[model samples]
Target chain A: MNEADILAVIRDELARLAPEIAFETLDPALDLREQVDLDSMDFLNLLTALHQRLGVDIPDADAAKLASLASLVAYLARKGAAPPP
Target chain B: MPSLGADMEAGALVEWLVKPGQAVKRGDIVAVVETQKGAIEIEIFEAGTVERLLAEPGATVPVGAPLAMIRTEGEPAQAQAIPPPVDRPPPAAPTLAPAAPPSVTHPSPAGRVRISPAARRLAAERGLDLAALTGTGPGGAIQLADLPAAPPAAPAAAPFDFSQMRAAIAAAMSRSKHEIPHYYLSDTVEITAARDWLAAANAERPPETRLLMGALFVKATALAARAYPEFNGFFENGAFRPSAAVHVGMAIALRGGGLAAPAIHDTADLSLETLMAQMRDLVGRVRAGRFRSSEIADPTLTVSSLGDRGVEALFGVIYPPQVAIVGFGKVVERPWVVDGAIGPRPVVGLTLAADHRVSDGHRGALFLAEVGRRLQTPESL
Candidate 1:
């Protein structure tokens, strides 16, 4: 699995958690804070799910990079763990 | 999701505590969910019509999971026909046919209200009462600044009153005083040199970024801990857990005699100016009761200052597991023989109370000496 697969899973899990909005088609360039109405608890839940499913440790120091979808994909790519094309 | 009480993890859905189509008030526990933690009440704040039920008796979900669709009261539920998620109870068919033109405009009832999402979020985080706000925005929507600056706390109804907050504090203090063996040491420091350095340093910085006396105290405490690392940790579960980094909690007294101590994370890494700015900000938030739970806990060491109250000497009761607390007394002018001549000099007292089980008299004395030295020459930080 790679960045795209991971991103897809994230979108699905987020949508499942809070179905009030249509966030599936949101652009990677859009800020997560702006695109989806996520509070601190939601952010924590998102990270917990990612860690459980992807075997990644999003340390508090690096957590800021997960603020947007594009940044997350780019970070995963730099780590040589991008989602499969 | 199961609502959590004081001790519960998972809860059984007992029943719908509120009736369908009935208006529910904010914080109204509309449902009761029983668990090992006990019967817990589920609550919400939005004023809305219960369009559908998402969970039934005997079923359970984690806390914070969406459990129902609450459409604004008086708004046509089907006018916004977003499909309800699975496991949610389905609503009856729209009273008006789907083909009927939408009759209501459904304009946000608060006319022309246009608060920024960010402002609204901040208000929520701080639990500010939006209804009390006189908004400054074009639509009379509350701006961030327009939100009440402090947490809403009403006066206790009766004399000799103790709130739940006071009860919790009493329990915590009782536990700390009973469990922690406290040994104390106090010293006086002549800060003539340190004051000069601090004044010079402030002169070099921007007005908004000057280091205040509180920052100097925090920096000195962090430095003193380096000389006495054992004091820089928490004692928990019958053992001492040493912290990799020292986070100093600064105690702030709340308006009504209750107290809060919000930790200044990594105070040592921050420059004096930054520490000053952050300290001021955190202190304000503490008084406002705006700090998150994370901010309130996990301090490696703690400090309390009664200097402003003109206290000549004071010692704090140990906040347990955190091995030590340092207190500062007010600086006062006294005639002292410095370099052989008598002259009035500003002098302050330092007090340290350490866990006797973990810290000896010698170590406590050493920590106090170092703190006095640093207070005398705080520019070293």
Candidate 2:
């Protein structure tokens, strides 16, 4: 999928985890855990959701690198998580 | 209404999942009640048919008040009269008197009146007759206080709002600190083995079925509790009653503000895969504001974790009735001595806050050590 599409998918999953988080006010560079106050379980669920939706496997070792919104979208793009054409 | 937690004095009935005349077996979710901890699905322990609904959907009822009447097996089908809702006073200090006045008359005394010295002095000073007063103390003993006329019972109702939840938490924690003589001990245990084992296990499993370090900590704690019964029970009425089963309460922080530690029943018997699934389901249901009454009520001991994003360690306050609480902190790399060689290893901070009345520091130390030892071999858990 495109960068914007991947970003949208991430936002949707994040919203499901924390409905109170406002995506418009969320800074893409900020740590998602601090921004949304999500614990480890919530983060794991987010990754699982993204993996199911984008068909990209995010191993636990790479979890630290995708802590921010911008990094997560970029990583999904790098992983070639393209929708079936 | 059932006592969802120690601090839950009252709850508002949100909805009834079962209707009158509906047949229900034991462990059926009967209704939903909104407490300070959010909506809890009330479960019925009796196998019976619903005779009548006592409380309305929006009525705020005190704990132990009748919500419904059930006709058990082999009972006549005769219609039973619905009892009126119990008028309970608002939650207050234990020193406060009950709203209902004690009956003035008593049965003929077989022996001398059992009155406290202080009460005797107070009665003589006040020119009051001790024979006319009823003693509410232990074994009909009169205490040193004048019995005032019973006041009007006030409804212990509060809005089912978030701030009220904060108030409930404040009440519970305050009660815990005031009542429980807490002794805290901290130990940093190496979890490299557990981490490695989890990684290898998860590498072959699907993401949905993969295990987390939390499940291991819970299992270890449960097993250690089984070995050391002192740390797994409730201290009530000046006695410690040990539980036969280890139902570990996992503290879940709510998104809005407060937290709830609901029990994962029979944690010691659950496999790692099953424990992880149950943990995930519990967290999801807690966030969704739906959990069973027994989950909220039947925790023999509590296990709290700050998660990987939190501080190095936390010493939790023992939730009252329960004698102990075990806390797990974020796992971080720290220099350690392994085979007399210093190297970096993944270790997590473990803390135990136990009631001094139930167990001393020596036994508490052994319990913590046992937990650490169990964590060292996660495969057994």
Candidate 3:
């Protein structure tokens, strides 16, 4: 899948997890935590949602790496390409 | 009968988890009560044999009305607690735990309906009569998974509306603001230590098992509540009765435009990890229209965090009979001073709306300060 496809998948999963978040207007460069109204539980659910929708495991060790939307979208593209076994 | 909330004067009995002749211990969920918000599983505070189920299912009873006739331990014990025969190995052992219903000798709910938790919920929501339905689950039990395909379709459900729910919430919040003499206090605490600790802790966990800042706020507020009794208890009849246990309620907005702040019983006693797990389950079930009766009834204090939307602070009104409510706002980087130097630091606004009858401004300030101090030392929490 392309980068936009990966980002779309992430956005869909996030919508289900936290309906209050406005995905369309979020700045890609801003941290997801700051850009949208989400708690730690919401963040955890986002990661879980992505895992369930797409067979990829974003372990807790990489939390900071996935902070911003750009980072999350890019990392997800790579994970979607070569998913962890 | 337990008071589910400030707005709730009475509730309809939905289902009884226990029955007459059943021996129950403290903290056991005895029944489910239907309020305006939804079904709340009621808990028995005193351990006893249920003499009778006073309030039948579907009956609307007042808050203080007796739902069950409980015979305490001090009373003559008809139900004997027999010690296990240590040396003898029986062919099969009977499980006494309430959760493991299948392992019991007679895992029946007496003459009452024996429906699974999920089925019971669905039945309630769909306005189906479970008593009229047949069970296909193990030991004639009703499971949600199988029940949908068990038999003929249930009659069309009553059209539940959002307007009625909105009215109920408005009534409760309006009553709180009207009667309670509220005093407000706010403090900004630097959560760099707490935030750093949480990130480090999450790095060691799987993504699915990470902790949240809300959990830390809950635990910290609970610890502070223990020291400052003024901010943790119910107010009634022009007198303040302090609660011994710290059951902190997390205010969760419902999917259908209502609010439910159910208690996480004994918050002061729970570790940070356990509290996080409990909050997750509570939030999930609440939104899914499932709440335990104890959670609805036993909150000494309520906590709300409005940080997700970049809100700087939330000054919430006290939900009376409960005298106090705590709120946390957005955690943002600000210019903070440390050791006569200013630099960027992560800070959160902690605000308390407490009853004037219970304490004054000085005491409230101290309670908020204690919460800040607790957050500073995350290791202790």
Instruction: Give me the candidate number with maximum lDDT.
Output: 2
How do these models rank on DockQ, best leading?
3, 2, 1
Q: Calculate DockQ per candidate and list them.
A: 0.01, 0.13, 0.30
Which prediction has more favorable DockQ, 2 or 3?
A: 3
Q: Write the per-residue lDDT of candidate 3 for residues B1-381, one digit (tens) a residue.
A: 566655555667766787688888876667766666666666666777887777777677765666777788788754332211111111111121111101111112334676766567666555567777888875577766555432222232222234545655676667677777888998899999998998788776766677888889999999999999988887776678898999998988654366778889899999998998899888877766677766766688999976345588899877667889999997889999999999999999999999888889999999999999999999999
lDDT of 2 by residue, B21-100 (tens): 98878776677677777667777777778999988877788776778888887887854432222122223342222122
Order the candidate numbers by TM-score, best to worst: 2, 3, 1
Error of 2 at B215 (Å): 1.2
CAPRI class of candidate 1: incorrect
Clash pairs for candidate 2: A1-A81, A1-A82
lDDT of 1 by residue, B29-83 (tens): 4554433312333555466666677777666654445566677667775422112
B-chain TM-scores per prediction:
0.62, 0.79, 0.77
- RMSD in order of candidates: 22.4, 17.9, 10.8
The collision pairs in model 1 are A2-A82, A2-A83, A2-A84, A3-A82, A3-A83, B1-B62, B8-B37, B53-B89
TM-score of 1: 0.52
Spell out the clash pairs found in candidate 3.
A37-B308, B40-B293, B41-B292, B41-B293, B42-B293
Candidate 3 scores an iRMS of 7.9
Error of 1 at B210 (Å): 3.3
**Model 1: CA > 4 A from native:** A1-85, B1-162, B203-207
